[model samples]
Target chain A: MGELLRPEEWTALRLSLLVATTATAASLVPGIAVAYLLARGRFWGKALLDTLVHLPLILPPVVTGYLLLIWLGRRGPVGSFLADQFGIVLSFRWTGAALACAIMGFPLLVRAIRLSIEAVDGKLEEAAGTLGASRAWVFAAVTLPLILPGIIAGMILSFAKAMGEFGATITFVSNIPGETQTLPSAIYTFTQVPGGEAGAMRLTIVSVLVSMAALVASELLARGIARRLAA
Target chain B: MKEGLTVDLDHRQGSFRLQAAFDAPPGVTALFGRSGSGKTTLANIVAGLVRPDRGRVSVGGTLLIDTNSGVALPRHRRRIGYVFQEARLFPHLSVRQNLLFGRWFAPRAEAGAEFGSILDLLGLGQLLARRPAGLSGGEKQRVAIGRALLAKPRLLLMDEPLASLDEARKAEILPFLERLRDDTRVPIVYVSHSLPEVVRLADTVVVLDEGRVTAAGAAGEILSRLDLFALSGPREAGAVLAARVLRHDPAFGLTTLGTPAGEIHVPQTTVAVGSTLRVQVHARDVMVSLTRPDRVSALNILAGTVAEIGNTLAGESSLTVRLDCSGAPLLARLTRKSVAELGLSVGMPIFAVVKSVAFETSHRPPAVREG
Candidate 1:
């Protein structure tokens, strides 16, 4: 493993994994809540909320990143408030890159989970409720188990998107080596100079291996859950 | 202890409106109606799934809902078990897991101490490890029933649990349902469009039609009244006799049933001897005579006194006459001309001749009798 890539390349690879995992884990609960609301809730402003959730998907990634920077930058409104109140920072840091990746992947996560929630039979939830399960318990037991496959699919999709999230991440947090620089940033840096083809190719191969492993893991998990759920 | 149910509710969805009120005093009180007659809506209201516009629902005098004072309880806290038309067993759970899903919520004092007996009662002992997807329709319904029973509910609401099954599957599950009704001793509100199911399972019957309650009374009395049958089944007005199988004549393929009316024989049934069941005698199949016809070809003759005469509308030739055969109610559809020729009066003694094969009787399986 040491001979395959230098120290900088390894840091970029590890940083990319860290960013993607954080983004995926951070968005899971809110993503599911929004997806269920869109699928089953009847309320005002639902259409606007839906469109806003999908804005990252349809909008250019740079614009999403720019908007995020405008609102969450050090001098920006939320950024300044968070910095003063909590002594935390996100701009130009790895955390900002993770935020950008999460925003970029959120639409995929919400869409996948929403589709599964729609496919689930609401009557089953009602059955659990009548069987003495509270509303929260019903969701945890019946709704969560039934939608396990969809949640896994969403996670895989979001992870893939986060892994390749170049435009938003780069715009929000510039290519700072050993700081915000992830695999994509490192590969771009390698390709910008002469005699850098080998390094760039190596990192690209690493990216492919990471994504393929995630895909295969998702497949196995989905099949195992399906088998357990069926006879 | 058998806790009775009382409900008086009014609700409307779109253009459909429902107004119903009835009392269910233990055993199975069937909501007998046709497909769109609002039986399911009433059940949903009682179970807290549907909120009625105005109503009062109480189980064993404990108020569950009272729109007058906003005393409605949520569905999860109602402690009422429901077996839907389709067995909505959780696909992700094993049979044992499904059975215990609601058992956790029951109070500690009632948390299914009879769990092993219930599994035996539903024949689910061997299926504990299996999931629901591969089970047959009958097996799935049995599991559903067992799951609801394990909840230790004060009352059970079954909305045609056998409606989705085929005839053979219905026959397969009917005996188990009978056993559940008997052994569990839970007051059940059974909803169905099938008349035979009502006669076989219902102790008290509440008849609904076009979103209105036409009548509610003891099952035998409500069923014997021709006017009540006209609400849903106009032509099936008959008597429901509580009979027990005495013996079987295997040589002639016949079974002897001892009813309060007299000894009656019918086509051989698979039900075991000494099993008690309701036997339905159709009005169209009866031929009444003033004196005993010695040379009649009919195999059964019941001695009775004409108790009541149905109203004969102008220009209508046929009317119904009810007979009290030793306290057993029997209905006979006779022509106005026949009544006038024989001078049939309320006290006149008559003989009701019915062919043995015309008895539309219920055939319970053998397993339901002794166990």
Candidate 2:
């Protein structure tokens, strides 16, 4: 394992882990909120909101990256406002790569979480309300604990998707050596060069193992939560 | 006048419109109605789970909802506990934890009831460590009741708490509820469509028909009124009586109860002497006689004044007679031919003869309370 992973490959693998972890953690709260709204909220424009959330999954990765560039670029409205007010920048930096990865993985995360939230019984929430819990307390106590498995699954899915993201990250943030080149981008670079097959294969194996571990962990977590909630 | 509950509500969902009004005192007030008659909806409005389109609800002088003033407290702040038809216990929590969920959310100043006593009262001590999934239907409802009681609610709303249980499970939970009503000072607003359940539990009956309040009075008087039953449906018509156990005959294995009019003998009850028992007498179970026949096997024979006479339906031979036995009201269904032959009319005296075997004991004494 040590010999197959060249210095650049090792750096790519570490960077991929850091970027994926950061993206997944940052998107978790909003992902859950959006997913719950899609699953349960009853409003006039609910269907429209649902379609908008799923737009990323249907569009080509490069197209989504270009849209992100226009919207979150340095001179874009949100980007300039955030940069000026909070000194936060997300253009052509490692943070920009993380943002691209998060956007790319968001649809999958929300889909999984929304399905789980839909499965939770709304009657239980009403029961909680009648038991003297405020709406916020009911959500925190009953709804959150009941849908924990979905939240964990959503996180793992986002992490896996972020780890493998390539087209969007390269287009939006550019493939910088120690900054934005994630595992998939680094593997693409290695395959394009001569005598880089062995390194590419090693990184490929690493990606497969990481994804498999995440799936198994999610299965176990979902099962544990299911057993706890089995009535 | 003692402060009680007064509700006048109007709500519309889609095309369904519900408008109802009633008043109940400090006792077990039953909101009795059939399915789709807005019973659960009314209960939800009382618990603050549903906001009525227009209404005014006040319990013991505390305004809960007033559309005119735009004052509506949320469910949690209403301090009214609700027990749903299905026991909605927290599946992830143990029985003990589920019971404590409401207590954790309740303000510390309002938690006056002792936890140990509640456990003992519900007979849930042995199941404390078990998860909700491991419990039987009866046990789940008991835990639900304990959870609501621990929250220190001023008024409890039970929406057919026994509706999901089988006969045996219903039997298991009925006694616990009786104990809850008798022991706690908190008034209960129980919602049920079952006549037997309302007869056994309620002190005041609020009969609803198609989202309208049809009858509201003491349980015995309301249950005996055949007109209310005819308006609501005959399947739910029955009479409820309040009686005290007079004596237990060891030799014959019979217990005699002293009701308002006379003594009633039945198979020996497990309850001791002097305990009040609510007995339900189905209108169909009664037979009338103008003269007292000798050597009859029927155990309950009481003289009563004919209160009212009403025909069942067109071309039906039977008539429903409302009888006033001393102060208690009883109902007897007799043939119209017999009623005419006997010259029965309002204020005429007659005998209501009931067979002892037909009287089914509605509830056992609360398991935790011994007379």
Candidate 3:
């Protein structure tokens, strides 16, 4: 494993890990909030919100990346406002890659979490409220713990999706050697050259191993949560 | 008007409409009804979980809801503890955490021996560390009760806390409930479809039928009303009497109870002397006779005057006769044939025979003064 990976391959692998981690961590809170809202909120425009969240999954990956670029580009309306207000830029940067990955993986994250939140017994939350817990307290103390498995599942799904993201990441934040290039982008770059089969094969193997490790870790976490809930 | 509960509410859910208003004295006030009879809905309104379309609910002078003033308290702010039928304990938390979940939100001033006494009273001291998944139905309910009590609620609402348990589990929890009502002095509004449970626990009984209050009074008076027997199935017709333990006869394995009417001997009970016990004698288990019969195996024979005679309803084979045994109320279910043969009528003297060991007893702990 050590000898076959060149320095550039190592960079891609490390970059992939960093981008996936950032994407997963950044989306965690918003995903949970959206999931809970979708699961429990009874309001107008709920269906529209649901459709918007799931649009990335139904649209082509390139189309999603293009949409993100149109809205979040340096000269774009949102992009210029964000850059002027917060001095933050996303276009052609590793953060853009993470953003691309996050948008691409959001549907899976929210879907898993929403299902789990829906599965939680609302009656238990009512019981908590009657016990003198306010609405926020009920959510934190009762609903959060009950939906931990869903959160874990959502995080893992988003992480795996972010790691494997290629089309959206390349379109939104083009592949840069040590910056925006994730594992799939790096493998695609290697496959384009004549003598790059071996490198591509090695990176492909690393990608598979990382994805497997993520899935196994998620399984362990979900199982642990289930055991605790059952206990 | 005094220290009690007053509820006047009107609500509509789909096709069914509920309009009820009553004042319950401080004690265990039972909301008695069958399924879809709006008993649970009434309990939820009292707890501030369900809002009525128009009404005012006040417990011990604290206004929970007054639609006239547009004042409605949220459930958490109501400070009324509710024990649900399913217990509804948090599956993710241990029993200890579940019990303390309410304490964290309860006002500190209301906190005192409520926590320790509830833990002790419900016998939840041992299973604190166990998760709710590991608890039996009865144990979970006990924990649920403890959790509610620790909230230091002024009024406790129990929505059929034992309806989900089997007979054995219910038997296991009933005594704890009796002790809770007697010891805590927290006015409890218990919702139950089972007449036996109502008779066993409630000091005041409010009978509901089709989303209306058909009867409301003391348990003894409500249970003795033969007119309400048609509402609650005839099998549930019975009389509840307040009696004190007279003596425990070790020789014949009998315990004598002294009611206002007469002395009743039953299979020996472990209750201590001089403790007040509510005894429920089902009307069906009682036999009516004109003259005092000799050589009868039944241990209870009370001389009484027929207070009221209810005619047989359509398609009914039996008639209900309300008897006033001295000062205590007794109910006897006699067949139409027997009623005619014995010539039973209002104000006529009669003898009611009850089989020993047929009475259900609810033992109350000696009342403790509340601050």
Candidate 4:
């Protein structure tokens, strides 16, 4: 398997895994908070915020990538401020690929978690309150545990989406061969050049296998949480 | 200790308005009302779960809510335990964990209550490791009660804790509640619409009708009022009496209670001598006899004068007979025909005969007895 793929193909595979894992892990906390807010909060401008979170799913990936590039690219307003203030550069870096994937996968993550949070019985939270638990403790002990299955599902969905991401990764980070080339981008690169069919096929099979593995892991995690909660 | 709970509340949910006030001093204060009568809403106000638009609530001396001073404490901070209609035990935690969940938040200074004793009191020793899903309705309520007590709350609010149970299950839980009321110092505000439950459990009755406090006083006096039955509804109308186990007759297997009315013989109680029992006599179960009939099997007979008479919308008849014995008020419901046959009128002397089986002895201990 190692001999079948070139060094650059292997590097892209390794980089893609790193980027997707980083993206999923980094966005988990904020994803849960946003999901909870959407599911439970009643406030002005909530619909607008929800629509904004869902924009990436409906807008063309290239358009989202362009927006990211303009807003988060170095020398752009937010990008220049971040670069100067925090020495962070998200243009043409592997981190840029992670940022693109996180933004693109966020809607799916929030949606799964939001549905689970909404499904939780509010009466249970009130009971927790009466049991002397503050609102924060109630969320930590009751709401979080009850919605854990959804969180796992959301993380897996985001990871799978990140692994297959192509348009946003390429448009935002320019698909550098060894730096920012994710699996789909690498496969796209292999298909574009002459006599690259074998590499493209190999990367495509790897993508399918990775997605299947994530789906199975998600199911197992969900089942384990359900059993623990039931017991 | 001067144990008391006072709540004067006024609130509105959309178009529905709730304006109620009642004072319950210790014991089991039963908030009696029909469904949607704001019984639960009032309990929630005490628990600090629902903030009243205007009024003050204090349990034992701690002010939980005082809208005038803008001192409305949050539910957790108030240290008032609430048992919901459905036992909302945390699904993720084991039974023991759910019971101790509140302990983690209770102030360390107030955490002297022993968990072992609480579990023993509620008969929940064997259920420590099991999750709530594995428990029966009765067991769940016991665990809920234990959880609330372990929090060392100054007040406990139970909103129809047995409303979800069947008859057998309710019977299963009532004994534990009796034990809790007897053993614990925690003041409880019990909410229910079941007449038997109010009779068996409550020492103070706060009757609410359509979000207003219709009657509130000693359970014996307030529940026996015929006016409350007309105002609150028929199903929840009954009288509660404080009685002591006078003697246990082995031959008839009956326990004679020394109540205000007379020596009432009830089905044998397992309680010891000198222990007080709360007995509920439903208005419908009481009969008015013009004279003490001979060859009667009924053991409880008290001579009383007719206090009041009223009828429900369904044409069902009810009569409140205030007995001269011990100055206690006893309610006897007679048919409209019986009312005429006995020629019962206010100040007319009559015999109120209650069957031995009709008196339900609620076994709550005297320590938590509300005046």
In candidate 1, list every pair of residues with a backbone clash: none
lDDT of 4 by residue, A1-231 (tens): 348667887898899899999999998999999999999899999999999999999999999999989999986899999999999999999999999999999999999999999999999998898878899999999999999999999999899989988888899899788888888988888899999998899888888888898899899989998888877
CAPRI-style grade of the A/B interface in model 3: high
Docking class of 4: medium
User: After superposition, which runs of candidate 3 have C-alpha atoms over 4 Å from their true positions?
Assistant: B292-297, B363-371
At residue B190, candidate 1 shows an lDDT of 93
Per-model TM-score, in order, reads 0.93, 0.94, 0.95, 0.93
lDDT tens per residue, model 3, B1-371: 45899989899978888999999999999998888999988888888788899999999989989999999999999988899999999999999999998889888876444667788898888898999999989899999999988888888999999999888788788888888888987889999988888988999999888889999999888888877876677787888899899999999988899998799987777899898887888899999888887899999999999999888778877888889999788988888988888888799988889988787677533333111
Alpha-carbon DockQ of candidate 2: 0.65
In model 1 chain B, the worst 10-residue window by lDDT is: B362-371
CA-only RMSD, every prediction: 2.9, 2.7, 3.3, 3.7
lDDT (0 to 1) per candidate: 0.89, 0.85, 0.89, 0.84
- Find the 10 residues in a row with the least total lDDT in model 3 chain B: B362-371
Instruction: State in Å the error of residue A62, model 3.
Output: 1.4
The lDDT, on a scale of 0 to 1, for candidate 3 is 0.89
lDDT (Cα, tens digit) per residue for candidate 4, span B188-212: 8889988777777788888888898
| CAPRI quality band, candidate 1 | high
Give the CA lDDT, 0 to 100, for residue A7 in model 2: 82
Q: Which candidate would rank higher by DockQ, 1 or 3?
A: 3
